[model samples]
Every structure is written in structure tokens, then in C-alpha cells.
Target: MFRKRSKTTENTAATASTAVRPVWTFSSSGWLFLYHFGVIKCLKDLDLHRQVYTIGSSGGSCAGAFLHMDTDIDEVVRFVLSCALEARSSFSGLFQLKRYLKNAIRKFGTAELPNKLEGNYEISVSQLPWLRNRRITKWRDMEDVEQSILASSCAVPLAGLPVNVPGLGYCIDGMFSDSQLIKALVLGNSYFAYHDHASVTICPFYSSRAHITPSEYVPLWWAFFPPSPEELWRVYKLGQKDARAWVIKNRGRTNLTVTPIPDLTDEPEATVLQDGWHAWENVGEEISMLATGAVARLWSALSHVLEALGWTLVYWELAVHTVLSAVVAALAPVLPDSLKAGGSTAMAWKRCRDYYALLLSLKMVLKMVPALGGRIRMGMDAIDRIFSLSFCFRLFWFLKQSA
Candidate 1:
């Protein structure tokens, strides 16, 4: 889930009054995961440049002008630590919530992934002969139920997924070019065709079962992207990395595996499922270090570009959450009765911690103002403090005292 910056002018009175709330999210082909062109255009409409701020960046519009251009290993470590600390605050939580809530409200009542095919609900406006239009109408509010209707959803190399009809041919890198077949995938196209219960696979993986399984869209995203195991090794090789050499040099050990592609068909054109790439996932080399180094290279390049543009990483805290987690984690150690009281005690602790933080922050303000002014002040302060944590730390200390 994410919050979009309000379209309202950042300087406007109403814009100043916006409250932080959680944004609701749904995985879909229609939204969030737009096509390449769509995403470039959508980014233009976002609040990223004008209303957004980043404390450290390489190339985006809001890269902080204050960013130190001459960065070293130490600086990167410092920045990462700062980012991690900032993420754990109360205000950051609000940002997440507000983004989530705003997204939820903005995208409420939209279509969702299906649970299965031919189970219930309709897809693509087709009123199958066996069902009345009212039966489908009754389920418009339920996206999952609607998605289950004989949609052509696609699955990937993942061990488990919904099945409509198995692919007649295996797709390389999980790409599907077939129009009718691809359209069946909720991740591919939103189109659907009418099929009677007998024709339908009734399995959740079938994209044809649109109304049958709406939640299936998320896995589709990973299938669309992410490197294949082959690509992972190729990338490492192309980058002049040699974890294998390091392993041989240090431990005289090399992990090897014979991955076999599953032959699902008998034809010449049949693609194979390159399973048993367990060696790649299970390699004993410095795999994590290699992966991290590769990612860092890209991130470093991007950071440099964004930094040149004055973008900075914006940091915020969800503090009501910040201390409550600590209290919850430490309760078992500090309190003799904590284990016996169980998880509920920690939950209750969080609820009260949140309430008290809110109350305390409210009381910090002058009490004589009218309700509107007070609200405005609180909203403005919440917005202000999101950009910095000095005030939050003070509040954190106050909350601890009360606790």
C-alpha cells in the first residue's frame, strides 16, 4: 500500500489539514504495475518532485542540496544506519498508514484477484447461461469471488500456484506472447472469455478463472521480473565477480549441482522447466556478499545521479510503534509474569503506548485554542516532525516516563 501526495496545492489551507492514515493496497495488473510507458507518465503526475523531499539521493528531483557529494564507504554506512533508525519511528508508521489509507480510499471498490475458476461470480461482463445477472451483481463487492470465474491466470516456476490450463509450451524467463492465452492471465491482460463449468479448470492458478482467484496477481509480478537462475550467474560473471574462485582459494570447496529441466511434453517445440537449480539458491560461496555488491553498484550509481539533482532521503518515525515494540520484546525479560500473560499483554501494551503518545503530543500544545486551530496545529506539527526526529525523541522520552 502507498499514499499519494494530495493533488491539492501543498500551500493550501486544506492541504495543510490532511491527516496521516494507512493506505489500503491490492495487487492488480491494471494499477501499481503499469507498463513501462505508463509508469514514466505516471511518475510525472506524482508528488515526487515538488511536494516530496529526499535527504540523500543521486538523481531524482528532490535530492537534498545538502547531500555531501564526496561519499565514501563510511558515509554510505552512516547513511544506511540513519535510514534504518529513522524507519523505526512513529511518524514513519503514519506515513505508511496514510499512504496505505489514501491508496485504499482512492482505489476502493475496484476489481481484485480471484480465488478459483467457475466457483462463483462473473468475469468480463459475461452472464453465463447457467447463472442470472443478479448472482454476479450480488458479488460485485467481492473481488476475489469475482476473479475466480474462468480467467486465464498464469503461473511460474514457483512450486505451487493456481492452474487453469497448463501451458502447451513452456515460456522462457516466464514471458507469454500468446494473445488469447496471455489475456487469460490477470497479470497479462484484463480480458476474459465465457466458458461453461465443464470447460473451466476450476483451479485457482488459471488466469481464465479471473473471478476464481484475485489474490494471484501479486505472484505474477515476481514472475514478470526477477532474474532466472541462469541470469543470476551470468550477471555475476559479466560483472567480473568470482565467488567461485574465492571459495576454491580459501576452503578448497566448490558447490555444484545438476539441474534438470522437467520435460512436460513430447513435441520438438516444448519448453522445459529448469528445475533443480537448487545449486544456485544453495551455493556455498559468498553468495550474499556477491548479491549485495551487485545491488550496491546499481544503487550507488543511482544515488550519485539523484544526489546531483538535490534529492535527499526523507526520514520519519512511527514512534508510537517504536517504543511499543521494544516494550513488547523486553517485557518477557523484565517482567516475571510476562510469559504467563502471553502475546496479548504485549498487544495491550502497544495499544496503550500508542494512545498515551497521542495524548501526550496533544497536551504539549496550548489548550485555549478553538478545535479547528488545534487540529490545524496538530496536523501541521505532525507534518513538520515527519521531516525530522528531534521532537519525536523528546516525545519518546516522555512516553517512557508515563509507561
Candidate 2:
């Protein structure tokens, strides 16, 4: 007898669970930190089987994740127990690991080297997964760099157009204005550069051990190609446009001219776009510095002004505003946490606030597709240059005024 075919075949195994993820302050602190804290939570609960984790400083609403493989929290707790046992039995130094981590982070962060951070984080987990085989080596590839070590101040490229000097000059003139000074500072400081459009030229006035080098020195093999850039462009594997622009800008030729590239077949060559990525990635950091620095200074002044206006909760408002800013920055590519490394708690808070505003501006700009991103990036970049100069100016002013 033929059996009737069923409309549905059923075997019960629910699709893997994916919970709604929680957002973090982004790079302000990596969420991988949760793994550091979460397992401790499970250990504290004496639940071992419910938590397994992985974390990193990559992009995200969260830094990393913790998973519970088996349904039992107690089973998870066992790993933490093992780690504790190993620490007590074979690695007694584990007692001081937390202290070491705290001190190291504090020192590395602000250079002030505080004894420790004061905030506490809590996580609850049921179990611990054994540490998997992992490789932790410091091998930053050149392609990871996308940041221009040589900022606009010392290195800028012209788009090569009929630029109106008066218009550009007016732009410069406006920047020198008190309000515009802030604007310029915010934009230009990204990679600080100045332009004298009348001469149709731009120059870099800001640099900090910043150098611009290709990911790998041009391949020596390319040197044998025709001395013309067009040929070298193909053999050197240089970007179709940027490489040509660099040659023209640096070699001082406007139209395509035959140019010879140097060669040393024996010189060491690195691999890939890794360095370019790193360079580009640093753009976020530069943007943040200019943004935060401007906001911290301006908002502080604004706070005083608001206080005079008898606005209550001025400080509280500042705190809220700043936290919001930092969260926004966390979501963006990069924004500086503060003007310099290891800034004060107050300073970091200010950066966070600025980051939020910057992120908002970027989000608005991105709403219109690629145009806004490019234009805003360019405009803010100009402001960043101005910021670098103004920062120096402010320092000098403070020094002289104090003296």
C-alpha cells in the first residue's frame, strides 16, 4: 500500500538563537571587555556551562560576544574554576592580573597613569567555555593603514579646477573670524592645510612625525617600464588616479609628463593594501580630535554663558550631552576620545560629547548618498587644519597671558 505524502515534515530543532545585541560606547572601550567581565560573573555565580565568548576592537553596537553552548550555567562555571585553579595552583600571579590590567590601561590611556579606573561593570552568565586555541601576535600589516601620516598641513592635493581665489580667500577670511576660527579649527585640524587660492596653491603647516609613504615601496620591476607615468601606473600597481596626482603634485608637473620612477629590485617589499587601510582608518581619529577639541572649548564657554542665563542643570546637561556624543562616536569609523592621549576624566567626557555631535553631522551628511560624505569630509578637513593652528595659537596665548 502506498502511504500518503505529508504536506510538512517536522523535526523539532529551533533555529539558532540570536538575541538583540546591546550597544557599547564603541571604541571608547571594546565590548570584548564583556568577555573579561562576563566570565567573571559566571565564576562568581558558580555556574560554568552557560557562557562561551569571543571579543575584539572591531566595529559594532557591541564590542564582542559571549555564548552559552550547553543550557547549564554550572557547567560554564567550571572553566572559570579551572582558570582559578590554574591561577592558584600553577599561575599564582593571577591574583595581581586585574591590578596589572587596571594600572596598564590607566597609564597607557592618559599618560597620567592613574592607579585605576573607578567605574564598575557587571555581567551575569551561567557557564564557562574552555579557552580555545588562539594566536595573539602583534603583526599589524601595512595595508591596515589608511590614515595620512602626512596631514593636509604638509601634504595636500588639489582637484585641479578653475578655483576662484576671491571665493577661497573669503573662505579663509571668514575662518579667521572668531566664530569662524572655531569652525576652521574643527575642520582643518583633521590634517591641517592652508591654501592661497590667489596663487592657486596649498601648503601644509602642521605635521607631527607624519610621513606619507605607499604601502610598499614601488616595485623595482616597474622601474624597467617606460619612464612615462602611464606605463609605470600599470606596472607599479598604483591607483589609477592618486598615484598620478601624487607624481604631478610632488614632481611639479601639471599635465601628464613622462616621469621616471626609481627602482631597487633588491629592496624589501611588503604585501597588500593593509597599510592603506590603516591610513584610511586613522581618518576617523583625526576627525574626532578636531571635533572634540572644538566642542570641549566652545561648550565649556557655552556652559558658563548658560549659567549666566540662569539655566539649571547646566552641568548635568553637559554630562548627558557628552555621553550621547560618545555613543555616536562609538558608532562611527573613528573620533578622538580627547585632544591628546590619556586626557582627564573631564576631558574624555568632553571628547565623548563632541564625538556625538560629529556623528550626528556625519549621519545627516550621509542621508543624501555619497556627495554629502565627500563634501562634509572635505569641509571638516579644512576645519581640522584651522583647528591645529588654533590649538597652537591657544597654547601660545595661554602661555603669554599667564606669563
Candidate 3:
């Protein structure tokens, strides 16, 4: 009886220690960090944080740190709110947010990071112009951590520049690499080899069960221009509410997965319906290409015509006014002072001349207001690139080969 009881206890202990751990992965979410805070609170409430391992990329790195530490949720809320307010207070661009982030991290960041032994956490970043993704589990000091977080958050064109980390080289946003399915597949294969855990992804924006399209559009927009305190609070609460629902539904679950939203540039998988070649199918494609190209060219030509007509009207108006002013000056002697508002004819004529010159100067400067021509050209170019006939042909050929 004693031997059986000891065996039972040992089995339970082994299961408790070696059971599949929860791997929580967070994607980069700028001001949307509030949503993550709410989710983390839900996890902590259920005493699940102790059993969860975290992986974060970009802005997620900051959230991941908070999750790893014994930090209060309220403290994190205050931190997030304060950071957003400060970053958005004096500026109107994402670059300002970057500056404020660096300053805040330097002021408040500590040189000591909690060891993975304390709680497993990983940060992801992409080395610029070359490598798409790299995950770091160890850090040398406060600066490294700060740089890593900033590097991961760097979105090209939108956010000013990629961060230069001492050992990581120049790096951009981690989302750029993982946004691709092929890259994500590679990462997944490698991730399972080293980490013996089941991952649960909690996305605040969109999910298969929920289609929050409006929220999907604002992830970066909010970072560029942080919303009102009321809106931020609402989003945070929504995240908490969603997370609680998720927990209720997925309680005692061992495996969970969340799909990342694809960007506009992400290549979709090519599907082939038939194995045999059909040359006749090219007719519809060719027709589509011709129609789209003709429409684009027509629009471009119309814009140019309108612009020219607008300028011609402006010039004509100026010429007509000049002729009228000259006629007025010539007839000033014959005209009554009442026509000039009780002023002398000479004074009225001088004022008229000055007004004509002012109008002429202003009209000339209208051309300097910035050219719509370049904008029209840019639009046409975008249409050509996005709806190119060559791309369609290439896609058709690929599908044929794949089939």
C-alpha cells in the first residue's frame, strides 16, 4: 500500500512539471499595448502567468517584460497611458513617438533584466535590408534591451529609421519578416524543436471568430496619432473582455494558435484549378488588362486636360481684368468721382493699378502651390504597377506550373 501511494505521488509530480506549458506570443502593437495589458490581467487573474512562457516582437517586447516581471497591471496601465499622452502631446507624427519611447526607456529602464529562469521570455527583431527575423533571449544590459525593443518597433517609411543595435546591426520591425507565410512556417518548425510548450496567441484586433475590420485599420494610425483617453480606455476594456471570454472557452486547453493578419504586400498562395493548359483562358485576362490600362490612361489624360484648362481660365481672367483696368484708366477723366467712392480719379486709378498687380502676383504664385501634375503621374504609376499585365501573366504561368 505504501509503495503504490509513493508511485501515485511521483506520477502526479512528473505530470505537473513536464506538462505542456502555455507559450503566449505577442505581436507588435504600438499604442495598442493597452489591449495587451488587459489580456495579461486576465491571465494573471487566473493564476496562469506562472505556467506561461512569453515571446514578443516590436512593441510586444515591452509588454512581454511586464508579463515576465511581478509588475502590477494598474502600474502598467498608468505607464501606457502616460507614454501615449507624452508621445502624442507635442507632435503629430510617428517619429515623435520613437523619440519619446527612447527617452522614457532610458530614464526608466534598468540594466538588469529578469533571467529566463525566472520566467521564459523572448524578443524578436529583424536585421535591416537582409535578415527578416531574429529572436534574442539574452541581453547584456539596459541599453541592449532598449535598443532591441526600439529596433523591433521600427516600421520602415512610417517610423523614421531602423535602430542601430551594437551587436544586432541595423534592424527594422519584426512583423515584416513573420508577415510572410513561408517565413512563419520556418520559424514554427524551429520553435517547436527548442521549446517544449503549446502556444496560445491572443490577438486584440482580429480573429477568425471576430471580424473587427475597423480595428484592423488603426493599429499604426493610432500610434501616429494616439486616440482620446476615453477611446483608449474603451479599447483596453474590450481587450480584457475578449480575453476573459477566450479563457472561458479555452480553459484546460493544451494547444492554441492565432493567425497573424496579412499586409497588403504579402503574397497569397497560388491555387491551380486544372492541370491541363487552356490557351483560351488567356482571352479574358488579356481583355481585363486592356480595359484596366485604357481606363488608367484615360484618367491620366483627363487630369492633364483639366489642369491645363484651369490654368488657361486663370490667365484669361487676368488678361480680361488688365484690359478693363487700362480702359478705366483711359476713361478716368470722363468718369465721375462717385465711381471711385468720392476719391479723386488719379487716386482711384492708382489703387486699381495696385490691385491688378497684386492679383497678378498671387495668380502666378498659384503654380508654386505644389504641382498636381506630379501627383497625377504618381497615381497612374501606382495603377500600372499594381495592375500590371505582366504580373497577371506571371501568376497564370505559375499556377499552370504548380498544377
Among these predicted structures, which one has the highest TM-score?
3
lDDT of 2 by residue, 183-260 (tens): 233322222111100111111111211121232223222211112222222222322122233443544432223235
lDDT of 3 by residue, 126-234 (tens): 7767755666656666767777778777776556688887666798877665453321121111111111122465444421112111122123345446776656665
Error of 3 at 307 (Å): 31
Q: Residue 329, candidate 2: how far off, in angstroms?
A: 15
Sliding window of 10 residues with minimal summed lDDT for model 3: 1-10
| TM-score rank order | 3, 2, 1
Of candidate 1, the 10-residue stretch with the lowest lDDT total is 54-63
- Candidate 2, 100: how far from true, in Å? 32
lDDT of 1 by residue, 1-403 (tens): 0011122221111122222211111112211111111111211222111222111100100011111122232333233233323333544331232132123223322333122111221222112222111112123223332122211122222212222212111111111211133322211222221211111111111122322222211222222232233332222121111212221242322122212323314312212222221121122132333556667566544433332221111112343344544554456456443121223555545544543454356423332232222222334455334312223333332232222
Runs in model 3 deviating more than 4 A are: 1-19, 90-93, 103-111, 114-119, 181-198, 207-220, 255-403
Cα TM-score of candidate 1: 0.16
Poorest 10 consecutive residues by lDDT, candidate 2 = 146-155
Q: List where candidate 2 sits over 4 angstroms from the true fold.
A: 1-344, 360-403
